[model samples]
Target: MSEANKDLMEKYMKEVALRRKYHEQLVELKGNIRVLCRVKPVLKEDQQEEGQAVVVTTDPNNESALSVINKGKARAFELDKVFHPQATQEEVFQEIGPLVTSCIDGYHVCIFAYGQTGSGKTYTMEGSVENPGINQRALKHLFNEIEERKDMWSYTVNVSSVEIYNELLRDLLSKDGEKLDIKINPDGTGQLHVPGLRVTEVKGFQHIKKVLAKARRNRITFGTKMNQHSSRSHALLCITVHGTDLANGSKTTGKLNLVDLAGSERVWKSGAEGERLKEAQNINRSLLALGDVIQALRGNQTHIPFRNSRLTYLLQDSLGKGNKTAMVVQVSALESNVGETLCSLKFAQKVCRVELGPAHVTISFRMTRDAMPYKTSQR
Candidate 1:
């Protein structure tokens, strides 16, 4: 082999070593779905006149347990991880950083935020511009990793953002508010495709930051009794990474889905009317469907109901039998919202019990022959 070819082969070998290292680390971290609970601090304005009494507290004995006090009774719930109101955005991301990195090693990953209105779901997923939250941190880490591996592998990253409002899918990146159609690919990959969605090829963190800003502006939000600017739809941000081994003829495709579900709320509590009422009902309906899917998965049912909701349908691949998933359940600590907090925690508990089969890497290799240089077979 020529000098250039020899150098390329050495680089490829190094890439293979790095990939194997990541793969072994991922295997150690793989398991059933994980659930994390985060408690939001009670704002001064929301505090009772006499400090009626704080209703939520973390267990001193167990860091992963939360104590919820109501009417002189205390109940404890356990989770994979629990973040107190004082936890910083950086602290929260530290726990999930490994799962995010696994995507680069060819594993599908889905991270979702679930909670009641006025809870900390949005805050945890998308914090202030100065202290960006999980989505931003994950993207930055992913880009940095890509840069480090640029010498051995070439990567193409594309991003697509969409929102589900009133059971309809709208492209958050598009200028017009047009409903998009979703199709299930019949190629046996069990992937859902949004035909008209505008996916942008992102070069780096700055490019993705601009796309995120545009999507946030286009997302549907409205005022509610609990939150002034409550999200009226479930917004999903998808990052598709396609990597090619430069020296060896191999390819890998991985996807990371960051979802911010609209807060689950009661219609009467929110005092919804007209459009708001419709939005609330739809949101609740989709959440209910999600609950059903989780229940079925937990029971190890032969047929999982991914088709019950648009959100579930679109996420069939990621939530199915062989992917890594994590959920951050946000809760409010105010006494007034105790009931809703309990409900959110219960749902999270169920989510924690659902078992997704062992995670697998989605990578394929190509064989080169003297006669057929371009032929490839997926393994």
Candidate 2:
């Protein structure tokens, strides 16, 4: 590159950095914890159901509010954002693109989809190849963001996938489907770490796609009365970004967690039995524990109950202080699902009120890497 070209690139980078700083200010003004509601489209099967009626409606005047007609009375709920039935996957990703990119700047960010069975949580988190969802879009965005900053910083992206089933943590990227355990870092950082979990270092979006595909194959799903191929476990995709400033050699680590929670459905409705019954019980219990933790956080309690469940405990770092978190509560518009939809919206409303404080960039002088027992390819 010519000296003149180098100077021009440097000037452009400075401008980009300044613009990002202003954008961060705007995001901070919005809040650290965001709660979004997405009303899943009424599918053909939902239409075929005898009792299926349109009970949920979006407020045209208020994009942030939704109304549900339950017990012949309409109740309105407000959230940080609301996606109507016609909203496309691209539209949903656009709303969260900024949050995804924030991880490149060393912020711990987590976005999870929560809802009842077959309410489209998985679809929203992992859309079809024709229209990829947040997980794919977020990683691709990070790749572009990193490439733009390559002259100023060098980064390594590590990916890990885990499933929480029956209150047990399992490595979703492992061939043997190994059960895992969470422990505090021995170095006294008070950070949680999962032992025996698989972490893959991806050079770019293609590598991430392969990693996600393998994890998806290993995730547990089952046929239930509520829906076919229902997720039996909470699937969590954790992406950690490690960057070293080229100018100063200072290092920073940021993490982005994309979680697809297991369906929060009633046992009687799902007709769960035997092993399925056990799974449903655990899933509901863990979700309840999560709600309790959120309630404690909203009340500013001294104890947050992070250890009440494995799902909550594993997400301690991301859910606790100085982290950006968002929840996309997926709901169905079918009247048959009105009760579950109401429950999901109410939960989202509660989550919206919990202030997680401002997220800080994590920088450290220590240079360390996790021991890799699995395959990790880099460019």
Per-candidate TM-scores read 0.84, 0.85
Which ten contiguous residues of candidate 2 have the minimum total lDDT? 361-370
lDDT by residue (tens digit), candidate 2, 1-379: 8999889978877886798798788677776777888999887777776656799999888989999999899999988899999999999998888887778888888888999878888889999989889999999999999998898889999999987878878787888678888988898888888877789999999989999998887664322322434376788999999999886698888899999998887775657688778777888889888777766665567898989899989988777766777789999998878899998988888766555443232112122122444434541
Model 1 lDDT per residue over 1-379, tens place: 9999889888879777887786646645645367889999878876756575678898666768998988889988887788998999999999778877777767788898998867877788888899989999999999998998897779999999988877888888888746898897778885778888999999999999999998887764322322434366788999989999886759988889999998876765757688778778888889988877766765567898888889998888877766677889899887888898899888887766545343232112222232464544521
Candidate 1: which stretches are off by over 4 Å? 1-32, 48-50, 186-190, 220-230, 269-275, 354-379
Question: Could you say which candidate leads in TM-score?
Answer: 2
Which RMSD does model 2 reach against the true structure? Answer: 14.1
Each model's total of backbone clashes: 0, 0
Which whole-number lDDT from 0 to 100 does residue 167 have in model 2?
87
Candidate 1 RMSD to the correct structure: 13.4
TM-score of candidate 1 to 2 decimals: 0.84
Which has the greatest lDDT?
2
